[model samples]
Target: MATRADRRETNPDLGVLAGQLLFAVQRELFGSLAELGFDDLHPRHGAVLAYLEVDGVRATDLSRMSGQHKQVIGTMIDELETLGYVERLPDPADRRAKLVCPTERGRAEMVAADKIMAAMQERHARRLGRDTYAAFKTAFMDVVENQRARDLSRRP
Candidate 1:
């Protein structure tokens, strides 16, 4: 029988592989969060909170960074606000605009998530040797940076 790893090796589509890994990581993250008493949280919420700044950021900026529609990010922000994880405060630069800021609970969750991700990386390093894992991570980041550069170059 062909093992899953063998199958992945045979059909090596980086995008598909990346997506599978992302979903697996998300599952583990969600499970860990639930165990930590954040059962109400949704995986989609990560799109906004994962890259959010400590000070706060405009909703439009979050939408752009997350590559999500403004309305979609708006809905997530609303949900987060209702759950007391985040708050929309008037932007100091523009009173008409709102900045999304993490509440204490949200910051706590982010810390927990960081720990979980670190543990996950440690496990991967163990499985694939420390040196090899480091190289893999560096390569992945190079690819991501190149892609981001290309994307930015296309913008007006």
Candidate 2:
């Protein structure tokens, strides 16, 4: 055991651990994405890309899913549109609104990202034992959900 002179927290907290994990995975993912000829995409765009659906999704919904503001989502959508990864179409239900639809290139990127993330998760599971890793993921997600619900975040 170690002793500290003051009563300050010396260990990493949940936020630090989660943030480190996010950054490390993002660093690895973006590097691989570049090698795969997706150098145009950046980590900031992930707020939109990571939560996209096959059919289509609205920018407002993407904002909620990614826990980002609608303005941020709009900017990312614009960038993706310019890069030819996505397009906006009139919603069938409401012509007044538009749906953010992914193009073929976007679909390909999504598939690549999914494969990479699955591989990373598998590596960790192998290192930590499948059951333990599964339990940890479940518990962590529960904690996140609880905190989000309890906190005063702008998100719904």
Candidate 3:
């Protein structure tokens, strides 16, 4: 291990590690997506597409789930809508509000994303040993959950 001073100079903190992982995953995912004709999508679009449901979801819920601001979600919705990936329809339960529903293109993209993610995970698991990869995921998720809980509690 490096000395304390060296570590401090180049500390790989939790945030840094998380961001690196995110960027790497996005690079791989988005590159493949573009090759498959989803050239319109970007890393930011993952905020909405990654967690979207087949039925539809509310922008507020997407914001909460993705830890993104409401305005950001709305803007992504608008962009996706214009790109013919999503449509905002009147929510049946609450006509006052709209639900963000995927178009056929969006659904197809979702399916492709699922396959790509699964293949990536499997590749990583094989490289790292399945058990070790599973343990790492569990540990990472624990960290994520704890941080999310703490952030939520601190919110006004």
In model 1, what is the error at residue 21, expressed in angstroms? 0.7
Q: Pull out the clashing pairs in model 3.
A: none
Error in Å for residue 129 of model 2? 0.7
Q: What lDDT would each prediction earn against the true structure?
A: 0.90, 0.90, 0.94
Better of 2 and 3 by lDDT: 3
Structure candidate 1, residue pairs in collision: none
What is the Cα root-mean-square deviation between model 1 and the actual structure? Answer: 3.4
Number of clashes in model 2? 0
Q: What is the lDDT of residue 108 in candidate 2?
A: 93
TM-score of each: 0.84, 0.90, 0.93
Error of 2 at 18 (Å): 1.1
Alpha-carbon RMSD to native, per candidate: 3.4, 3.0, 2.2
Q: Choose the strongest candidate by lDDT.
A: 3
Compared with the true structure, the alpha-carbon lDDT of candidate 1 equals 0.90
